[model samples]
Every structure is written in C-alpha cells, then in structure tokens.
Target: MKATTVLAVVCVAACLSIHASALSPFGVGRSQLHKKRWWSSVDVNDLHKYHLDDDPQGYFGYLTQPMDHFDPLINKHFNQRYWVVDKYWKSKSHPVFLYEGEEAELELGEVAYGHHAEMAQAHGALILGLEHRFYGNSTTKEGLLLSELQYLSSQQQLADLAVFRVFAEKKLGMSGTNTWIVIGGSYAGALSAWFRLKYPHLVYGSVASSAPVRAQANFEGYNEVVAASFADPIVFGSEKCVASIRQGFSKIEQMKQAGQLAQIVKDFNTCQDMTDPNDFKTFASDLQGTFMSAAQYNYIEGNSSSIGTLCQQMMVPDPYQALVKMFNPGSTCSDVSFKDFLKLLTDVTFDPGAMSRQWFYQTCTQFGYYQTCDKNTTCMFLPEVDLDYYFAWCKGGYNIPSSDVLEQVNFTNAYYGADNPRGTRVIFVDGTIDPWHALSVLKDLPEGLKSVFMKGTSHCADMAPNDPDAPPALKAGRLEIEKIVSGWLMQAEMEKKHK
Candidate 1:
C-alpha cells in the first residue's frame, strides 16, 4: 500500500511479509497482520538446504559498497547486506538469480522460500538477495538528514547492483561466465526491470512482480483500484461492499460537518480527540488505508478470508459502525494524531526500524506516489485526504516544496521512461487485485518484454511459494515464468556454443 504520510510505515509492518511493495502511512487493523512469516510454510528440508550453516550470519553477507556511485570524490562506503543460496549451482555456466531489495531490510527468507528458490533448484541456479542502500542495515551515514538521503535513488541503487554483480562474480569464481537474472517484487520489482533496462549487459533477464514502473505525483488511481477491488468478484467483493465503504466515509463526513467530534471519536476508538481538521483527515485516511491494506494483500495465504470478511462486515446496516469494527477490532484506540505522524516523518534521526522517513524522501524526490483521494469522484476516502494533504506532509517533513516534488516526479518519468521502459527479456507481473498494478506494465511490449497478469491475485502473489491450495492461474503463471527463464538460459547457452 502507498500513501503520502507515515501511515505507510504502519501498513508496511502489516503487509511486509506478503509483498515487497511501498509502505503506506495508513494504520492496519490488528486482524490484518499476518500471523506468521510468509516463509514459515516452506518445507523444512528446503529451508535446511538453503540455510548457510557455516556463516555466522547464516546465509547473510555484507559487501563494502560505495556511498556515491556517481561521484568519484565521495570515497565513503557502507556495508550492503546480501543473502546467497548456491546449493543448486552446478558450474560457472549456471545462471544467477538476484533478488533486488526494497524499502525494508534484507531477509534470508526472501531467497530461501520463494519461487526463486524453487526455480533455482530446477535450473541449477545461484540465488542472491541484495539489500537496497539506506534501508535495513545498508545505511550510508549516521542519520537520515535530507543531505544524507541525497545518495538514495533508483539510479544509484542500479549502480550498486551493477558493481555488486562484478564483486560477486569474482568472489564466487564465476567471473563473467554465469548468466545473471534479476528478480524482485513491488519497489524492488521496479528495480529489477530498471536494472535490465539500465544495465542489460550485467543481467540477462528480469522477473518484475507487481512492479509499478510509472511515477505519478497525484496517484489517485491507487485508491481508485482499491475501490474497484472492493467490488471485484474475484476477491469475493461486491458492489454492495463498495457502497458500504462509501456509506461509511459519508457518515464520517456527515458527523464531522455536524460537529459530532466526540461521537466520531467514541465510535472509532481513536487514541486522541479529532478536534483539529488535520487530525480528522488523518483519521479518515487511516480508515481508508485499512481497506487499502485489505485489498492490497487480499487472498494471499493467511489473508485469503480477510477481504470476504471485510465485505460481509461492511454490508451491516450501520456501515459506519461496521467500518469501525473492521479496523478497530478488539476495540483498540487507534493513534490517529496527524501531528505525531508528522513528527515521525519529519524526524531525521536514523531509526533502522522506521523506514517511513527515508521512503517518504524517495517519494518527494523520485517516485511521487502520493495516493490522493480527491481526483477520483467515486473515491471511498474523504476529500480532505487530497494532494494538498500530502503536499503539506512533504513540505513539513522534508522541506521539499510541492512544485519541486512535481518536477522531480516528472524528471523520474522522463529518466525511466515510465511504463514504456525499453528492455528485453523482462517479464512484468502484476495481480489484478493489487492497486499498484495501476502503474505497472500490464501488456506485452517489444523486444521480449512480457506481462504475467494474474486474475484473483494480490500483490506479489506469484512470488509466493507454490501452495497446494494456490489458485490454478497462480500455479500456471509460475510455470510460465519458469519456461521463460529456461528459454533465456538455453538461448544464452546456444549463443555461447556458437561463439
């Protein structure tokens, strides 16, 4: 889920195990959090095989990475963490599958239990997952001061991957013989595709799952897709589900207009009074975000029944009460303070656990994926959660002017070519139910660019380990990805033989 405020920080924790997408500031209901890690279900034997028992870090290693890849004068370097699985690697000719890290820390589970591991076994491939700079323990400096964060951008990240590939090749004794394939989900997914586009010589192919390549400042389409997913029958959502959501928001708006702040607070169980208009907007945004998280991660493993339950709850006569029940299950008081959220976002003091400040900086200067509700007429969120709200957050947090934010967004699209990235052997995968798909490449493009658009699936659903209970489309999609990857390796071998 993507939003403007630190709400994404809260939602990231909720959905992190399921998908590697951008975080949203919107608070996730207690019930929405995944009970177990996504990799917890992986076969124990496979887990043992992938685990690097000899290393103290256990499948994890850190590389000395340049702080500024572009600036020769800046000699500062940091430890960039990575995980590796070479149990399936047969020879120097075997392919290497690299998982690009995103806004969060690099985890061993990423390479140990996903479809990448399954594919690595099938193809005798070496698997690696690299941590993105400034995220997790891959920090460049002591703090997240705006000046320090200047080093964090997609271009620099791609350069890091390029340099790391060379270093990894030397360390693994493969030099230049192995074919490298990059794989990632969500933000990391975008990096995968962009890596191929920017450094095709370094990577043979890319599996970009749920990657939103396009950059939009006022990304109202995010919530628009969320609203659509509420009515999408594939996820067991109905027209009435969407209507109830609208009704719920409408009731909140009516209450605010009638000056029933106390009644609203009592019903929603907010931690603080919503007397301030900004606080009221934050409360509404958090409510809308609960639905966003539900839709964003709908139908994945533990979450398969959540959307259905949400829809059922929304259909209750008093939708306002039902909405409250949906998010504040167990009747917990929600922390809906806009001022506190701002403090979190604006604070530059480095807290490895809280990545919202770093991510929001990226949004302000690079992607501009500010999800606003004002642009869409049928938006289920309050109008007060508009672009101006996000703009205020951006300005307050980073001192980045709204005009500069828009310019940077335009620059990002211009630099990356938005959705029409010129790349080969790239498969762009997206699930219909994922709101982030609005900005991904959903159709086939020239020069071997393809899309694996799955129906009734949510964010990065294809990357999940193949389950017996998984949908047929998802299983087929995985097979199709394998076939494409196999073909790439075979073609590379054929070219090598010819040479």
Candidate 2:
C-alpha cells in the first residue's frame, strides 16, 4: 500500500493478539461514584456504548488454566473465571455454538441477533459465551502481580477452552456425534480460528471474524486503511475531508515545533497548555487514537455510524476547529476544550475498564503489536510509537528482559504459524477497512480453510446482528459464512455417524 494522494500508506501503511485496536489511554479517570469499571456496565442499553462488564447475557463459572499446558502432570493451575449462556434445541443431534470472548468481556450480540443466532435457531443448537481470561472474572486474581499475569497468555487460554469443551460436552450429555463450532470476533476471533488449528479434533469448525493471526511488532498499515477509507467516495467521505484531516495534522505538528503550546491547548481543549515534548507527544497520540477507533469501528447501522460521523465533522473549515468538532462532538461551547468534554477521565481512578492496561501487558510481553507511525508510515495522527514503550513495559511491568520480547514473539509466531495456520475447518473473515486485516489471512487458504474479505466495511461488522440498514457486502458475507459453517457441521455429523 503506497501513500496515496490522500492518505499515508506504512509511510503510508498493522496487533499481536487479534485484540481490538484501542483508543488512546488518555480518558479521564474512573468515576469515583461508580465502582464499576468502564465497560463493566451490564445493562443491555450499555452494551455497545463502551461498556465492558461481565456477561450480562449469561452466568459465570470457573475453569483452571494450566501453569504449563504441555506438562499435564505439573499441576500448578489457577482457577480462571468463565461465563456461559446456553439455549438447547430439541434434537440431540443439534450442534453447539461457542462465542470465543475477547479482551473485552463477552456480549450476546453474536448469539442473540447475528448470523450465529440465526444459525443456532436453524440448527436447534446450544449457544454459549465464554469470557476471555483476565477480562471478566476469569483470572487467578485481578492480575495486579506479575506472577499472576504470567499465565494469561493466548496458549494458556486455548488449553483452558479445550478443557471447557470436554466438561461442557459431558454436562450437556452431548453424544460423540454432536459437534462444537468456535466463534468470535477480534482477539476472540483469532482465538476461535486458532483453537481449531491447535486442537483439530476438539472443534468441528471455527469463524474468526476480524482475526489478526499474524503477529507483527510494528503495524502501521492500520492508519493507511483509515486514510483509504476516508477517501472512499462510496462511504460519503471526500478527499476534501481527507485533506482537511491532513491539514489538521500538519497544523498540529507545526504548532508543536513552533512552541505554540497555548495555541494547541486552545485548539484541542487540552487540560492545560503542555510545553514538554513528551506531553505534546502524548496529546498527539490521544488525538491519533480518536481516528484509529473511529475508523476501525466504522460499521453503520441505521442512523448510527462511527466513521461517517467523524468524517462529516472533519469537513469543518479550520483544521484545529475541525479536530475539536470530530473528536469532541459533545461540546457546544464557543470556547470548547477536550478535557472539559471528557471530564470523567479527570478522575484518578478512571479506567473505563482495565482491559487497556491488560492488553498492553500482553502486547509488550508476547505480541509486540504497537500501532506505530514513522517517516515511512501513515497513521498521520500518531508519532512513531517508540520501541522504548515496549521495553519499559517489559522491564518495569514484568521484571523481564526487554531484549527477549522479539525472541518470544518469534517463538509464538512459529508455534502458531500465523502466516500458515495449520487447520482443516476454519473461515478467516475480515473487513477491507480494518487495519488489523493486514496481519490476518485475507486470501483463500487450503481446502477446508478459507477466507472472506468484505469491502465498504469496518471491524467485526459481521459479528453483530444483521442490521436492516447493513451494507449488502456484510449480508452477502454472512450468507457465505453460514453456508461454510453448515457444511462443516454436516461433515462433522457424517463422521460421527460412521463412528
């Protein structure tokens, strides 16, 4: 991908865990009045609005994650919190559907309203949602201590899922023939697809929605896609809007260089005028994150559209004012400020949910997935997220050798075969606009393994319920996904009958 006339492509043009790309960790502190963490809200109304609570649609339980999955006899295990919601069908032959939870807690959107739900009804299957370890209550503890967090790797959770499958099979009195299909979006999606590869016999098939199977330490293509999307004429975005965004970025860069701290503080409504280069960089990152989050979650449903809304606002005449418009829509004052708009973050306890910190730990130690920008890069909003951040996290957070991160990441890539996932029954689904898609399997694969890349779409659009106003590409993608999954079930059942 090149730096097109509109956007930068690594100068122009990538996550480690298939985790949902994040916003800047610059939100105000947690609400002191509310003990609930961000995303901890369980109300259905709160589900999509940045809420990250335990499964509101299901119940919770515990499963022990092995300290060492390879050594079964070495039983230094910790109980991990697990959640589930089950709806069984009449016939014993009905298949089971499992939604692999991601960095955020589990939600029922996949099961209650999407193609997965429709399939569950069509097959009269059992639907279950499992929260990923360390996200919800599924942890040795809060993971405050480095020792406790060490076991929270993807490999450890994969083993944990295998154990759950057997326990679930017996508990449901499922016959040898009744098969299970793992399903998830984002990190969970990556896990779902990989599970089948790692434990072929355990799951009949998988749907990895927006899964980033490949782990790259530097992923810059993310911003390039955002640039591409902004210039996409079909989505109502215009090159004018793209140019306005570019101008905004350039203006900010100029401001910082000129030591016009007072001007920037006035422009984005910073809490205070920042003179320090590091503080300026932090502010720039937060600004860039606004674009990252908006672009990645550009799915449109009815009047609700994330990227569309932001792009429209970018059309505001002045770049600085345009930024405030796009990033702080809630503000109405003639003299608006960014901090005033996000006053909640002012709370010291402010962690919308602890997932940001948690995911950061995983990335530094195992994934090396930093969404960086550089001379050859394009996410115009962010600076080159220095390798120092990863090094510091590793040394300070885990007391581990910083140099070992690359080696560990290499070993992990080899262990999982991200470029060449060895699997028989998995479908890799991705959105053309999703930055993570660069590291995911976007092309067709082996006989039983395949891929679906949807255009004019954003992250995980297929994972949600089929909105009446959804793009035709997603509806078509879901149809193909359903057909593929149906075939896998038939194959699994046929094998069962022969046995």
Query: Which number leads on lDDT?
Result: 1
**Could you tell me how far off, in angstroms, the CA of residue 374 lies in candidate 2 after the best superposition?**
1.3
lDDT of all predictions: 0.75, 0.61
Span of ten consecutive residues with least summed lDDT in model 2: 1-10
In candidate 2 the C-alpha lDDT for residue 492 amounts to: 73
**Candidate 1 ranges beyond 4 A from true positions:** 1-37, 40-58, 300-304, 329-332
All-Cα superposition RMSD per candidate: 3.9, 7.1
Instruction: Write the residue-wise lDDT of candidate 2 on 1-499 in tens digits.
Output: 0000111111011111111123311111111110111122235665454222234355566666666677778667666555455553645557888877666544444344455766776788877767667664565443545555666788878987888888777766776577789997666777888899999888889998777777766666666777887777656666887787888888877776787868767656655455644345445555665566556655465654555676777777787777765444554323222233223222223132445445555665666655666657655564524555335545654556766777777877898887678768889888876666777888888757899999877666676554456689988998899999888878777777697
Model 1 lDDT tens row, 23-136: 431233211222123564445555444342232223778898888998999977888988887778888778899988877666676666678778887898888889889987
Clashing pairs in 1: 6-25, 7-24, 7-25, 7-26, 8-24, 8-25
